[model samples]
Target: MADQEPIALLLLQKCAQVEAAAGLVTAVRALHGPSRTAPIVLLTEAEAKTDPKSSSVDAAIPIHCPADHAARELERWRPVSLEPTRRIAGILGPGPIAGMIERLGVRLEAAMGMLAQERIDQGEAHRLAGLCGTLGFAQAHAAWLDLSLGEATSLAEARRTTRLTLAAIARGL
Candidate 1:
C-alpha cells in the first residue's frame, strides 16, 4: 500500500443491475487508508432507483448535468481563486500582466487617496481614465470619465465611485 497512487477525486457509478459502489469504496480505503479525505462522488442516471448517498459517497450528481454545474459541484473539493491577475493571464499568458495589474491597482489606490485629499485634477482624471480603458477596466474607466467631465457632485463622491470601481476590478469583474 505504500506505493499506491493518491486519488484526488473518486467517482463511482451506481447501477441497479450491478452494485459495485461499496466494494470500490472498501478497496479505496484499503489502498489509501480510512483517513483519506478525497471526495467520492457517485454518478447516476436521473431515474436510478438506488439512493446514492446510502453507498457512503460524499455527493451524488446526474451524469448529464450542465458542465458548469458539475464543475461548481467539484469545486467544493478543490477550490481555485480567479483573481484579476489570473484572468488577465488567461488572455496574455503569465508575463508582465501581473506586474501591470499590480502597478495599476496601486495607482488606482493612490488616485483615490488624492481625490480624498482634493488634490486630484481633471488632467489626472483623464489620464487615469485612459489607463483604465487600456487595461480593460470598463467600470473604472467610466468612473474616471465622470470625474474628468466634472459630473461628480463633489470630490468625496468621486472618491467613493473610484473606490467602488477599483474594488470591482480587483474582484476580477
Candidate 2:
C-alpha cells in the first residue's frame, strides 16, 4: 500500500460508474497540469466497506453511488456542452459521436446486478440508480442516432427510452 505500484484500472463496476468517469476526466486534466499525480479507485458501496485497502490503489473515491447518482452531480461538471462531448468521445473512441454514451451503457449493464441485489445502502442505491438512468438515457439517444451500432429498436422507441431515462435521472437528482 505504501510503495508506488504500476496503475492498472480495476473496473470494480459496482455502482460508481459516474465517479469512474470523473476519475478519468480528473486524471486527464491532471496530466495537463504542472504538478499532478494520484491514483483513483472508483468504488461502489460494497467494495469500499468490504476492503478499504489496495496495494495498487492510492486512494478510494467512495462516490455515494449504487448507479447514476453522479449524473446529477455530473451536471455541475459537465463539459460545457460541446467541449465535454468532444472530450468524452476522445476517450471513448471513433465508434460514434456518442462513444461516451455507449461506454456509459456498458457501465450500466455491468452495475445492474449489483444494484438489483441491493448490495448497497439506500442513499448509494438511489445515487447509482440515477447514474443508471443517465447512462441508459445516453445509450438510448446514441443508439437511435446510429442503429448500425446496435441495441436500438426504432428512433421513436429510442426517444421514449431516453425521455424516461432522463426523467429517472432527474428524479434521483
Candidate 3:
C-alpha cells in the first residue's frame, strides 16, 4: 500500500508566466504516482513546432492561462488522489531537487530483501545510477557506486537491485 495510485504526467507549455511554469512542473513531477503520468509540455510561443511523437510521455496538455490559470490546472490535479505527496509539494516552492539528490543519503534497506547478493548485473548498476542521476536521488542512488568500490562478491547483484530501486522510485514519480 505504499504506492497504489496511477502516475499523472503534466505539461507547462502554454503559460507565459515563467516562474509559475517551473513551479507547476516541479509540483506535478514531485507528486507520487497512481493518477496520471503526464509530463509538463511547456507550450511555449513556438508550440506549433513541438512534436508529440517523441518520448515516453502519456499525454501533453497546453495550459490556457498565460499567467494564472495554467498553474491552477496543476493544483486541480491535486486532491483528486487520496494519497497526497506532501514531501514533493514542499520542494517546488522553496527549491527543486531535480538535479541535487546526489548529496543525499541512500536508504537501501527496502531493496536488500528484494534481490539476493549474487543475482545482480553490473550493466544494470550503470543503468540504475543513470536513473538516480535523472531522479536527483543522489544519496539514495549512490549505493551502486559505493558497492562497486568494495569486495567483489555480488557486485552485479547489488547493481541490479539498485536499478530496481531506481525504477520503483521513478515509477513513484
Candidate 4:
C-alpha cells in the first residue's frame, strides 16, 4: 500500500465482502501494475483480540471517545455549521457535501458505539449535541438536547436515549 493510503476503517458489519474482494487482488494486479491496497480493514472486538493480523497494526485508536479525551488528543479541531456547509457545498458541488455527510455518519456511529460500551460519560451527550447542532441533524440534536438538559435522571436512561438516536441516524431518519 502507498504511504498515502488510509490505514483502516473498521466497520461494525461483517467484512466477508472485503475478504472476498481482497482475494481477487493478485488477479487484478497481473493486468494492471498493482491493485491499490484497500487500507480499510473491518474487525470486531472479538476479531481484534483473536486475529493475529491485527498485531501488525502500528496503532488501533478508537474513533469513539469522551469529549475531554477528544479535546486533549485530537488536533486542528473546529465545528462546521450546516447552513454554511450547505452554501459551500452548493458552490463546490455535491461531492464535498456527500463526504461531509459520510464523515458525520462515521462519527455518530463511533459515539453511539462508545456510549453503548460505557466508554464515555454523560458529558458526551453535550458533545454529541454540539456535533448534531453543527451538522443540522435534527433528530440526533433532540436526543442529545434531552440528555444534556438532564431529562434523563440516570446514566442508563441517557444511554437508552442515545441508543434510540443512534438507531434513528442509522436509519437515515
* Residue range 1-173, candidate 1, lDDT tens digits: 32343355677877773456677776665553312434466777763333222444556677888989878766644411235435667788756665665677678767855764556578888888887666666556776877888865545434434544444344432
Scored by TM-score, the top model is 1
lDDT of each: 0.59, 0.36, 0.40, 0.43
lDDT of 4: 0.43
Q: Among these predicted structures, which one has the highest lDDT?
A: 1
Q: Give a tens-digit lDDT track for model 2, residues 9-59.
A: 223344546676657545533442211222233455533522222222222
TM-score of each: 0.41, 0.20, 0.26, 0.34
Per residue, candidate 4 scores C-alpha lDDT tens digits across 28-83 of: 32332111212122233232321222222111224454556534422211212245
> Order of candidates by lDDT, top first?
1, 4, 3, 2
Worst 10 residues of 3 by lDDT: 77-86
Model 4 has how many clashing residue pairs?
0
Query: Whole-model lDDT, candidate 2?
Result: 0.36
Candidate 4 residue spans exceeding 4 A from truth: 1-93, 118-123, 153-173
How well does candidate 4 score on lDDT at residue 170?
Answer: 36
TM-score-sorted candidate list, best first: 1, 4, 3, 2
RMSD, candidate 3, Å: 15.7
